[model samples]
Target: MISAPPPRPRDTTFGRSTPDAMQLSPDIPTVELTSLLGGGREAVILHNGERYRLRVTANDKLILTK
Candidate 1:
């Protein structure tokens, strides 16, 4: 009988953090939180070496800009 090929491994990085997240680790994305708290506003996060800015909106979502 024919056999099916082995299944591929799934990517577990869906909710995982990226390099920027690592650098901005520990901190709760100051700007993001600020904007979120400010209500319907946008905030920009800053860090070093990692080269990126974290943007958070009133929606309470974190987006890393490289």
Candidate 2:
């Protein structure tokens, strides 16, 4: 009898995993926009100790400024 190999671990933090689709590398993480803004029009993000502002425009577009 032949033994099957162990299953590979998957990361679902980005969203649901598609069994038939190729998965992305775990090194890169993805986050939803709604989760970041929390139902608000603006959000502040800190990168390399610098502050950046992210806002939603009246046209429903996104703008990011440092």
Q: Quick one: best lDDT, which candidate?
A: 2
Looking at model 2, the pairs that clash are none
Following a full C-alpha superposition, what root-mean-square deviation does model 2 have from the true structure? Answer: 11.7
For model 1, residues 7-28, the per-residue Cα lDDT tens digits are: 9998665555564534455757
lDDT of 2 by residue, 1-66 (tens): 999999988764543345435466878777878999999999999999999999989987789999
Clashes of 1: 0
User: Model-by-model lDDT, in order?
Assistant: 0.57, 0.83
Would you estimate the TM-scores of all the predictions? 0.28, 0.55
Task: Name model 1 segments beyond 4 Å from true.
Answer: 1-5, 9-37, 49-51, 56-61
